[model samples]
Target: MKVGLIGFGKTGKAVATAILDNNELCLEWVLRKRTLLEHRSVPEFLGIQSDEPGLIYSSLTTSMEELLDKHPVDAIIDFSSDQGIYTYGEIAAKRGITIISAVSHYGEQEREFLKELAKQTVVFWSPNITLGVNYLLIASKFLKKIAPWVDIQIVEEHFREKAGVSGTAIKIAKVLDLEESDINSVRAGGIEGRHEVIFGFPYQTVRLIHESISREAFGNGVIFVAQNLAGKEKGLYNFESLLLPYFYN
Candidate 1:
């Protein structure tokens, strides 16, 4: 399988490395705003080299049409700008390409676009793609089902490097029928990630918490999702949807 990576950031580089690690896949193209002068090859960007000789370096261009036309990948894994992703998704859907994105497109327009696109193609949309976070979503649903009438509150913390709230917390909040503001986001140094959804009543509380000791934990899971995103159904899918068998059953 040939993969196209749309971002050259930490997670994008991680996904490229993971794809190379999988003997069944190859890097077809990579997109970044500026090419790294020293590390032109995807392997070098990911800190690994491909043993396969004559492997092509992707064409670097600013235009999406040029990029898509130059390289035809089996699947396009987007980890780039939120706006860029949705625009590309529309194009990918029309072109009948497999698209998996790791950005949260949560506004009214995004939801409407994704809902319409799902009818014609399969796509996976999630704010975060970590397996543990997906598991947290699954657990939250069960806790809600068994204790539907319980009061719910979500709190989460991430590294200061991460400027936003925990995406997983937001997802859980949506599942529990809580307002988006109900999910609290905290930024702190030395904390890779932390999330807890608490269910409370008059006298007791049930909490589900998932933490990450290092950012690499999420890197590993994100790569796994990128590689496995081929040939899946066309719809707005989430990591929780992928983990349905493990926790839902």
Candidate 2:
């Protein structure tokens, strides 16, 4: 399947490389800022060579307009801006292109729009795409029951430039009926990513933690979703839905 990548950041580059590792997936186009495209191909920024002989710079683009019938793709795996979701989501719905977005942080109205778009095309939205984090999310459901009276708090740390709470932490808080105040975001030096779910009682605490060793973990999860995204019905999906086939029927 040909994929139109939406970002060229750390996760984006990692995912692009990981997708290329699969024999079935290849990059058709990448949406980057025009400023970044001033001189060289995104591959130069990413430091990876394209498998196609002459398609390196030709495939890099600054607009989704490049994703046309002349250069179509089966699906689009996006890990770009929160704004990119609406931009590509609308076009993909009309064109019947499947979208798997790893971005969170959209307005309520924007989310409503995406939900409507889902009825037109398949849309998978997840904050964090790591299998380990999904496992933690799955555990939250059971953990909620096991300790309904316990207090829930999410503490996460990311690189200094990352603002606000980790989307994974926010999702976990919501599932466990915790407030935003219970979620803490710490910005520090180049920590890959770390999430800790703390369940506290009178005198004890249980911390369920998942620390990413590198960006490759998230990239692996993106490839897994992309590989499985084919032929899915038009609707909204999450990480749990992606895992449903294996965990259930």
Candidate 3:
């Protein structure tokens, strides 16, 4: 499948590299905020040997409509900011392009915008797009269903530079019907990302933990979503809904 990437920051570069390495996915172009390294081959910049025209474009220089008109893609994997969707969502939806966004947070306005976009095309959004983290969430939810009396606590650890609580932790809390204040946030030195759900039972304690060793986990997640979302009807999808089928069979 042909894929366009939004955002070329540290995480974006990792995701682009993962796409370039995958034989089944083509990295079409990447849109970033700055003009630095504009129009450069993504593979060349990353020191990968591939012929796919993984070009880099600056949002300032190239309009989203111009880019989509010139080079249409089957899907767009966004690791950009929450506001990034305003730039390309409607244009891509009009053409029926799939959108997979991993933006960490979105306000009510963004959520409503995504709902409208879903009416036109397939849209999948996740705060934590790493497969393992999502799996942990699913498993935790399952455990909660079976044992409603268990005491569950969410703890999220991230790099010290990150401000506020982890969005993923908040998502977990929301899913489990816990308050935001119940989440425990730990900031440490250079930790990629870690989330643990502690389940305290009468007899023993169980823990489900997902540690993101690197940003490439996000790439793996979008690829998984893109492959599965290929022929689905227009709708908004969350990662857990897509994963639930796997647990059954």
Per-candidate TM equals 0.82, 0.86, 0.98
What local lDDT does model 1 show for residue 128? Answer: 73
lDDT of 2 at 179: 88
Scanning candidate 1 in windows of ten residues, the lowest lDDT window is: 52-61
lDDT of 2 by residue, 79-130 (tens): 7777777666787888988888887676787678779989999888888888
Off by over 4 Å in 3: none
List model 3 lDDT by residue over 38-147, tens digit each.
99999999999998999999999999989988888999988889899999999999999999999999999999999999999999999988889888888888899999
Q: Candidate 3 vs. truth: CA RMSD?
A: 0.8
Q: Which order, best to worst by TM-score? A: 3, 2, 1
On TM-score, the stronger of 1 and 2 is 2
Q: lDDT score, residue 133, model 1?
A: 76
| lDDT by residue for model 1 (128-202), tens | 777777777887888789878888889988778876666667777887888888888888777777888888877
lDDT of 3: 0.92
Residue 200, candidate 2: C-alpha displacement in angstroms: 3.4
- Scanning candidate 3 in windows of ten residues, the lowest lDDT window is 222-231
Model 2 — which ten-residue stretch has the worst lDDT? 52-61
| Ranking of candidates on lDDT, top first | 3, 2, 1
Cα misplacement distance, residue 50 of candidate 2 (Å)? 4.8
